[model samples]
Target: MSDWKVTHSPSAGRRPRALSPLREHLRDTFWFAPATAMVGVFLVWAVASEIDTRIVEALQDRGDYDAVEELLKVADDARTVVTTVSSAMMTFIGVVFSISLVAVQMASGQFSPRVVRIFVRSRITKATFAVFLATFLLTLLVLTAYDSDPDPRLVTSVPLVQSLVTLVMVALSLLLFVMYVNTTLRLMRVGHVIDRIVGEAFGAVALLPVGASAEGHALGPETDWIAHEGRAGVLRDVNIARLVRVARQHDVVLRLIPRTGDFVVPGTPVLAVHGGRVPPYRALRYSVSVGVERTFHQDLGFGLRQLSDIALRALSPAVNDPTTAVQALDRIVQFLAALAPRPLDASLHRDRRGAVRLVQPVPGWAALVDLGFAEIRGCAVGHPQVTRRLLAGLDDLALLVPEERREPLLRHRALLAQAVERGVPEASDRTFALRPDRQGIG
Candidate 1:
């Protein structure tokens, strides 16, 4: 019912073998960017300080009094600028991130909690944080290089290059601040959020392996079910290549016991080994990645789940916003129309020997159709705009999808008609609601 929290007894886990919990951790957290930035800032300051020393020595050896005096004056101004930048940066970080968090919270509340991950994975947000911290740290390093003595003879060499670099970092941080605020504002808009979710869905669909369902039936009886170990959470993704390679090595087929977005508990059977020597438990566990919440990394249905959540929230009595629900439905229609033509069946991973090593169960067309519309239709009973949009969405999908996949679409269309007939007492309203309008009315 909630976004990506549905648990299926046995379904596919997918993605490349290179991804792991650590990688996911870095992607989902804010620390990695800032930490990397700090380290980079230190290295840049060290190199720049060395270069400044070299530049100053070269100028003095040439006895260029004019250039040396100019450099000293620039160095003095740089020190003052660096001190001011360093002092203001901490406050800037606090104020900027504080406002950002509040805005993010408001957006999450207005949309769905799953939306938070989008902001977390946002390149702008990460870059903003990285630049801000880099500017602050670079300034600090530059301040440390300033000589205490005002005398030019005792000053040794001025940190001309370091100061310039620090100033550049400050300018970059300010520029990113503007961009960060703009991105945060866009995140709050429902239309923008839906578009982003749809974009992620398309990206996920591109990575999914398309094939016939016959392979799912070709697998032999399961010899053993491998129990999950360690902490409990949602099965975010699996290292499919590794699983296939391991299965091939053991002369068996490994089928994931749960889908990528399904919540998995410790001691649960995470994999089903079909007819061969059992592979090592450690290898199996290592290939599976779990997290506290579902991610778009591999979960194809997660996008639909998020869109559905937004629609559901909009239709709720607390919000009672039909226009928002219609917007959400607009995206839902777009997503399904794009997905309707794709092969929605289980895919088989085979070894070099032409034997099936892994079987991944993808969601059937009917299931996806149901996930996208069934709940919205039920909640849309009283709202004519949403009801009309549902009808229009179903009509759009009916035209785009192949005949074999149109049965569910037709069935949903009938269900919507029936719901409108019962929910709307007026004959005219029922007729209007049943009429297909892509914009829900106009």
Candidate 2:
């Protein structure tokens, strides 16, 4: 008993070395390795088998049975070919299975190199081994059949099954590819909507308790808050009425506007809002995306620079067109709005019974741009701040373009500058932040 125990203890003490991460990743990828190895081995085997068949058939036709018998020893070489083929295929399969599993698992979670390891091995990786085993069995069956007398039954069944399986897998892969593309597009649209609403337009927030699509804060791009799934307000200076205007501007129609002289003296509570009214814009923002294509109703989204090529290729296949470009303009407005910080509605609820007053007196050159945009788009410039910021961005980026394009773009700037030099009532600094109570019409 002591001798037996001593031998077992010695073996236990010399435990096997732990596998490296790479080895472990490839450990269950036995199928990929085998599949790859088999391809090469099978190629050699096929060539040899063809030569053997030709020689044997020719010799038989020539009535040389004795030569066929003499050359029979060559058949043993088939084993070497098959074995090498299987080993090579197993090795290749292991590598791909390991890599694919690790990548997908890493993508599924927080994207850390460490925590991702826990879920690294998945059902697909394990299933790959089964596929490899099936392939090996099929190879063995084929080799066995080649040596045996041809049976019409085996011939019809094996090839039919192989064709069916190939067809099924091809169909499945195509379906998955389409689904992945669609989902990615949807997420992109969400990011753009949020960015336009928060980053550029600022009107994305005019309506709500509900706000711009928070999706942009998560998965948009590299520095993309969307990828990290961070939560930030998608609006700034967002009061309830501004929120309403923001909503209405984006087609969040509640039908609460006044009709012709609906008997209003002063202080008539016109609109009543609930939380339900706000999420539509956010939803719409998240839902509006295209895959590798720009649309006539395009968006000036967060990741447009990266996506422009795919979009333009998809949209204009022939010529550069502004019809698709205008959609991008709206998208830009929405994406920026998604990042705007939410303001406390303190101003809205403030006791302005008589205190509602004008914002301040400053030359509203920015307002002039907003007005021009409003004229071109045929939408009331919902919020002046959004238009102001857009103009500022245009002015800042003007130098990036060629001298020729700059002149045309700057013509609007020139017009605004002229307005500032002269005087428009809306262009007054005081009128920019006009208080509700101070409205001349109301």
Candidate 3:
């Protein structure tokens, strides 16, 4: 029997909505969040300055200039201070950007190039940039409210409150700068990166529903294959809810051809509608979103791919960092443990009447196991530490999963033993590599 079986049957459909393009774009872009915060900060500072200026004017009109006399005395110095700080902040922004870019470049070189996405999408980095820009904007707005010209009747009043607020903003920005540096350093750590990827993978597994069985029901004879008509990219997400609605309306069973994270070229078969009535092509096309790269939003494989990439890169001759590969394997084991008990292949979306509408493709248990460990085992040929770690990970998974799920691990273990025996000519080295130890020491 084939290790991975893809069963095609009408299933109880899930109602997951497709991700909007705007939302997905905003999540990937580094500037949107910070830019929005900057606009908000500018408006807030403008309002506060106007309010402070009005209070001072009201006091002067009421012959109560003494209330703001201290502010008027230092008006000239306050304007100079705000101007200098704003100018200095502009220079500071440039420096922060330069340092951030350098750090990203270094991370990309040290890790896989795709890992740079994690740093760019970091919330701490975006918040730090927003705070710095907000402070600069606040300073400029407050500078406009400060008046150096002395009025003969003392009619002009300085914005004491606004100036103090600008100073506070500067203090906040400095504190955030310190925190941003700490965050950047933490992100560079291999353990932290692996943990992050593992966490996301676990979360994705949890989100997937344990689907009902579709054993007896077979697909209809009449089937219409839907072909993709655009540039090639990874199938990031499918609009399950929308697809279900379309299938129900047309009374057809829509079977997704390419699973999430699969690369589809133009004119590739994407969907198979098993019914007499054909659905609108545009509706079907727009329901699925293709992107330049795979994302963790719904594609669980992408998460595994990331960890696998890190492990492979570490095992490469240029890097040859066995410890890093071991760390990635540790996380991959955790992810597999989380997915062991779940029904991964049968995704069924039903309508209000409880009829199976759409069936989407998902990776089977054996497939996931292969994806998580196969390449790493292939690369661990000469490295005892990585070989032992892979054995240990497989052993741990065997103990955690059910009997039916244990066969793959057991088979892979034999393969690992063969590879180790071949790679290490000495009997003692082979024994050590075959032993299941976290550190690969007998």
Q: List TM-scores for all candidates, in order.
A: 0.91, 0.24, 0.88
lDDT of each: 0.80, 0.33, 0.78
What tens digits encode model 3's per-residue C-alpha lDDT throughout 1-442? Answer: 1122334333343345444444655777888977897898778777777777787778777877666675577665677778889999989999888988998888777777878878767778888888888888888778766665666245464677777778888888888899999988888898887777777676567655543333434566645688888789999877777888888888888888898889999999998877656798766767878889877766778778889999999999999898998888888888888877666775666776877677777788899999998898899989989888899999999988878888889988989998887778999988877888876553
Which candidate should be chosen as best, given TM-score against the real structure? Answer: 1
Worst ten-residue run, lDDT, model 3?
A: 1-10
> Which scores higher on TM-score, 1 or 2?
1
lDDT of 1 at 431: 88
lDDT of 2 by residue, 1-442 (tens): 0110000111111222223223433532345554654464455445544555566667677776666554443333444555454456556556654665655453333111222222222333334444454445444644453443233222211122222232343344345435544433332342332232233223222322233121111111111001111122221111223333343343332212221112333334323222223333343232111122211111112133322322232234343333333343344333323323322111121111211110101112233223224332222133333234335534543544434335544665454444433443454642551212211122
Q: Which residue pairs in model 3 clash with each other?
A: 12-348, 12-349, 13-348, 13-349, 13-350, 14-349
**The candidate that achieves the highest lDDT relative to the unseen native structure:** 1
lDDT of 1 at 139: 82
Query: Tens digit of lDDT per residue, candidate 1, span 168-251?
Result: 887888888899889888888998999999987886677554432223345756687788886899988887778877887888
Error of 3 at 101 (Å): 2.2
